[model samples]
Target: MSDVILLAPHDDVAVATRDLVPGESVTTGDGESDGNPTVVVVRDRVPRGHKVALRDLPLGSEVRKYGQVIGRTTRPVPAGSQVHVHNLEMPRMPDVPGASDAASDYAYATEHRELPVPEGERPTFLGYRRADGRVGTRNYVAIVTSVNCSASTARFVADQFRGRALAQFPHVDGVVALTHGSGCGLVPTSEGGRTLLRTLRGYAAHPNVGGVLVLGLGCEMLQVDALVAEAGIPADTLVRRLVIQETGGIRATVRAAVAEIEAMLPELDARRREVCDVSDLVLGLNCGGSDGYSGITANPALGVASDLLVAYGARSVLAETPEVYGAEHLLTRRAVSPEVGRRLIDRIAWWREYAAAGGGTLDNNPSPGNKAGGLTTILEKSLGAVAKAGSADLAAVYQYAEPIDTPGLGFMDTPGYDPVSVTGLVAGGATVVVFTTGRGSVLGCKPSPSIKVATNTAMYLRMHEDMDLNAGRIVDGTASLAEVGREIFDLVLAVASGRETVSEELDLGQDEFQPWLLGTVT
Candidate 1:
């Protein structure tokens, strides 16, 4: 097997497949080797998953990976030297002519290709069909808290349904308490308040939730009645509300909530999973704890599966706005229209200002864990992160927690934080999520199942029980990318058909229900 993987022919760097010592030699080709190869001797001791310069680079020279500009050389570096933060830095956004604005490179829909529908019979999954015409991958009772004051009460109510509490109701997926840190201090009309309300309403109306108990502290700014009114849940859907202050206290509210949930259990359990078309599925795409191999292995494989789902007329949502900073141009070119492309660029612009307000730049990403795993800058990471979206045309772009109304592939503006990102996706109506991680991220989302795909074999094996699938096999050379992608696509149907993910078996998603907090707390 080759010691390095070169993604594109004109790339300036190759990812070290294994640790390399000085004087070690590796060969590069256009990913698929044409008979001829160029050999470069390793000048630095490059660790596995890190980058090796394919040729001599002078100061300010742009470094390319995935055939895109990742960053630029900070100093003159010899070929075969390790290329990383010490020798490379993010390019000034202004210097990169077409990065943020309309330039010749920002052509809209230039790379957009309409997805051709599959010829065979469309695939199906066993799902709970809701009265509202939505299909649910899981049928659960949700205890949604309107304010932080009611969070504990909501959790307590959900806790009552743990263990064998719902054993008799075989179809029920158990109760989940959707709690968060902010709800009351901010003005309801503020961006943060509106975002919190949208997130809460989205979950209450989420197809995965068969019944909901909206809990709140009566004195709080986000009132229970207001949330219920705004949720627009079907009249027949079992939705109840409880106010802690009116109910006397947490104990009383929990008791009332538990009883309400108990009353809704039979109805929820009676909702059987009927055979539903794969088109009814909304798959959320996310990545966390990423490493260098992320872009090469799991991400691309997931992208292929995303493309397959889009071809089937299903919606696949790619989120984590900040993570996609540098690669926005790729998505813009694939936009279905100039307006959709502009919407994406506008979000990117918002992120730049948001970051600046906090005294940081969009390049503040590529977290410590990412750097340790060989990712050097946000540019490199964003290029890799965008792979999860596949090559589908950008159908629509949405604000954080907005309802996902479009069919094909869509983008949701959200923070790069794992739990928060997935929360927005789930709230936006994703029935299932596929999360790719190179450095073992054990994140899960209830109401919606999260399928964790590892980018490298060693981490997958080390954290075998936590991960649902091993895309690492692609990097290991044991399985082709298409095979693993098919495996993921198949697993999505299976999981949607009631198959349990590793996170579900471990009961790991209840606490991961974090709504993105925007604007100010007060």
Candidate 2:
């Protein structure tokens, strides 16, 4: 067996499957024929999951990985040397001709293909069906705060329901306090305010939330009454409201909020899970702490699961706009319409400008953790990140926290930050979130369950308690990609049918309710 894995014929580098020492030899194809293999002697220590030079690279030449340009060589590199940040740097975004023409110049929908209809009976899962025709995987009573000032009181109220408080109410999934940092100190009509409101509304009206308690400080820019009215929450949803000032103080507000939720518990618990079709599922795909094997293993395996769900008429959302910087063109080609393709490009342009204004660039990715895991450039990271969307056509593009009503596959514009990205996905109505991590990121979402998949076997073995599944079995040669993907697909349904993920059992969702704060704080 080969010591290193070469992803493509034109690739200039291969990933070391395991740690390597100097003087060891590795072999790869000569790019002309598989029969004539080329041998290269190891020149330096290559850590497992890091890239190794497949051929001698001259300075200023492009470094190809996954058959795409990841970066440029800073200096001459001999074959078998470890390729990383010290020798490679991100290249500037290519200025494609007719980029000024925007969406029209791209061949939109050229690669669009429809999923074949299944012949047998479609799959089904047990879920809580809401009055609005939406299906939920969990039933929870939510304590939603309107401003930062009321966050503590909301949490205190939710805390009152812990332990044996809900032992009798078997259907209730416990009270969750969805709190954030910004709900005041900004204009209500500004972009930031609007975004905050949208996120709050989405959560309040989410199918998983059977009841909600909207708490506010009364003096904040986001008024409690205005939020409740604008949200258009279904009349059947048991909702209660409280203001800190009107309720006297924190102690008084907590008491009132607790009593309200106590009264709501019986009704919320009365709702029961019923059989629902697979089409009712909205799967959210996100990745963090990525390594070189991420694209080759978990992300692509998750992509296959995403494609399986999309084929069943389910909506699968792929987020983190900045992470897809160098790979937007790939998505554009799979767009179902020119308008959809244009919107994605426009978001990328906005991100470029947004990053510049902050004295940074989109290339400010592949975090330090990513670098240690062998990812050198944002371009390389993005090429791998885009694999999570699979081959599904881009049916729609949505702004942060916007309601995801489209079916098949969609993209939501969000920052590369893990908490913020998953928060947006949950707020946008994802019933279940599948997070692929190469470095073992423990992230969970309230209301929406998060399934963590490890990309490499080492991380999976180290953090087995945190991960729900291991796609690393693919790299271990113990399982095929399709097999692990099908396992993930099966796990999604199981979780939707009321199985608890590791994150859910660990109670890691409450602190992750972050809203994307845009515009200005002041």
Candidate 3:
């Protein structure tokens, strides 16, 4: 595809992915005009991955993408005006009581647009099917622990099973240390502590895990046996546990864990990749450090990928609730039913109160960096952030870190914190994650791998070592959305089948485990 032109007909602006010089002639639709469309230099010089207007419009007009209003036109837009925050407003109702009779009727006019799905194609991917009926895109042996006390030992155990030791085991994809801090801190009887242990148990018992070793500092509030008993996990030859206090501290624990892993290695590496059905894939979608162009390019393209995955009977999880603020109504409509939509709406309300309790407002978002990048309000950002899910039917809505039951397209209640948000998705059974960013967030998660998509070409080129795919290629005038979506889908399979992402190679998953803290410490 030589040129990728995106102009939602209602939108008066069109974005140019590459740098266009002053008075440099360019053509648009049908045939070339006698003269170049009058170009207004929005910035000192137009850069790659930025935007340009399609035609002039009156002030207060809207800028559309994904067939939704991302922002409102500010100045009287001239033909080919470089439209941005300086010349736009977030799509918010006039903050006045009954300002205009048409105001109440002004809902998302672009919400009803039909998405064009390519004809006659069976989009599919390579994956693995588990005994529990869950599908996995990756194979991993996880060294999980009940609490922080066993974290170091867990890491020690996984280090002994690195993929390079193929001489001993070849079928194994890799090993990860999945330890967290909640195993012993608070009351074991409290709902929070009990929930924490359950999460740990779920991870250990997850079908994607080829083998699991649960470690604990025996004297901790959460006993290793307590997790297995309550969670109903089977006690099998593959399930092993080491108690540091009983095993004689870290040294003894490490030795015990190593021995157990050595015994399981042969079996863990014996499973090979079989052609699993496409329905076995569950993709997790997230975005970080988003800019104005993020919604227009990277996020939506990823959404296209999400749609493809779901259309093939797989699953897609769109998360980060706080970021979805003003644009939530769009997702609510996609919810499987009114109840599902209402549940999501309720969560948004809770977040508003939650933010206020902390003396913050939802609209107070748009970090300084975001504003500098021409993003004015949370409404504008949400419109962009929501694009990563594509247009699949919303099948379910889950609570933070809650198990992702029932497939197809879904929404998981999660915070906007990248590390925490991603952790929740992984814990909820997502075997792979796709993270899109405009300002560039170097983030990753262990156990389940993440594919980073860069929203701007400059960031992608600068951070090439971190980003796996450049959705910005669409913005740079080099690729099409569908093409990049295919590349991302292929990479998901590669990473799932043993290929490492930038984060995995750099060991970026260790510090990314952050659980959402809903209440205060006493």
Candidate 4:
């Protein structure tokens, strides 16, 4: 196997496939210099998954990878030296061209490939059909709290289903308390409060939820009545409402909530899963704990699956706004229309101002874990992160937690924080999420299953119990990108059919329903 992998012929750096020793001769090919490859001795020890300078670089020169400018050289560096944070620097934001200039590269997907699964033989999964004609991958009874004050009572209500309490209700996937830290303590009419209210309403009306019991502390800013009204709970909908102030206390509210769920269970349990078309699926894409190989392995593999889904007329949501800072140009250019592309650019501009106000910048990413795994600048990280969207034409752009009403690949504006970003996706009606990670991210989203895909073989083996699939095989040369992508697409069908993911089996989703909190706490 090759010791290093060259992503592009024009790339000034190559990724070390294994740990490289100093003073060792490294082989090169493909005419990177003088139309003929030449050997270059290593100047420093390069760790596995790190980059090696293919040639000497001068100060302030752009460092290229994935055929794009990832960073600039901080100082002159010798060929074969380890290229990382110490020698690399982020590009000036002002120097980066706006998405408007990128519109020239924008083109709708004109080459239509044959469907992966034949039209007549398209795949189907067993899912719960809701009264509104929507299908759900899971049958969850959600106890939603309107404010932090009612969180404990909500938890107490869900705790009634601990262990095999719902064993008789085979169709029920267990009750979950969707609680959060912010709901009150702010102006109820403010934009932040409204966003939070919308998030709660989305969960209540989500198809995956078989029944909903909205619990609230009546005095809070987000009123129970307004929430129920906004959720549009039909007269026949299986939903109940309780307020701590109205019920006399926390214990009473908990008791009422438990009784309400029990009353709703027999019918909720009787709802059986039936075959549903692939178009009924809405998949959310996310990545965290990423490394240098993430773009080459798991991310692009997931992108293929995204493309397949888009081809089938299903919707896929790619989120993590801050994470995709430097890569917005790619998506904007692929947008189905100029307006759609402009919408995406607007969101990027919003993030820019938001970060600046907080005395921070977009380049403040590639967390310590990412740096340790060989990633340097946000540009490099963003370039890899956007691969999860596949090559599908951008269908639309939505605000954080806004309902996803499109039928193809769409982008949702969200933070880079894993749980918070996914929370927005789930609220937008994503029934399943495929999360790719290089350093291992153990995450789950209630009402939506999260399938973790590991980007490296070693991390996959070490955390096999936590990861749901291994895309690392592509890096190992055991499988091709398309092959592993098909594997992931199939797993989505299986997991949507009720196969629990590693995180789900470990019971990790309940606490992860964190709505993106905006504005001041006061």
Q: In angstroms, how far off is 30's CA in candidate 4? A: 4.7
**What lDDT score goes with residue 41 in model 2?**
90
User: What is the per-residue lDDT of model 3 for residues 1-522, given as tens digits with 9 covering 90 to 100?
Assistant: 212245444444444556655555443443223333333444224444445665667888776654566677767876655666567766654332221322233232233324344577554555566666676665667777777888888888777766466455656667778877666657766756755765676677665677777788887877888876755343422687778889998888888888887788787666666766666777789998887678777888888778777766677899989889877878766766666776676677677767777897777777877765546667767888888888876778887767787768889888888887887888788888899988888898766778899988888899999999888777566888888887877787677666779987886775686665433223
lDDT string for model 1 (179-263, tens) is 9998888999998988989999999999998888888998888888989886867554788889988998988777777888888
Displacement of residue 213 (Cα, Å) in model 1 is: 0.3
Candidate 2: the clashing residue pairs are: none
> Candidate 2, which ten residues in sequence have the lowest lDDT sum?
94-103
lDDT of 2 by residue, 1-522 (tens): 357877877688988889988999988755423556767799999998999997899998899998999999999999989999999999877543333445554567679778875678899999988888889899989888999999999899988888888999999988999989988999989989998999999899888888999999999999998788868576668999999999999999988888898899888888888999999999999999999889999998999899989999999999999999898889999999888888888888788778877998889898999999999999999999999998899999999989889999999999999999988888899999999999889998998999999999999999999999989888788999899998999999999999999999987799999999987777
Residue 235 Cα positional deviation in candidate 3, in Å, after optimal superposition = 8.2
- TM-scores of the models, in the order given: 0.97, 0.97, 0.82, 0.95
TM-score, prediction 1: 0.97
Lowest-scoring 10 consecutive residues by lDDT in candidate 3? 94-103
> Between prediction 3 and prediction 4, which has the larger TM-score?
4
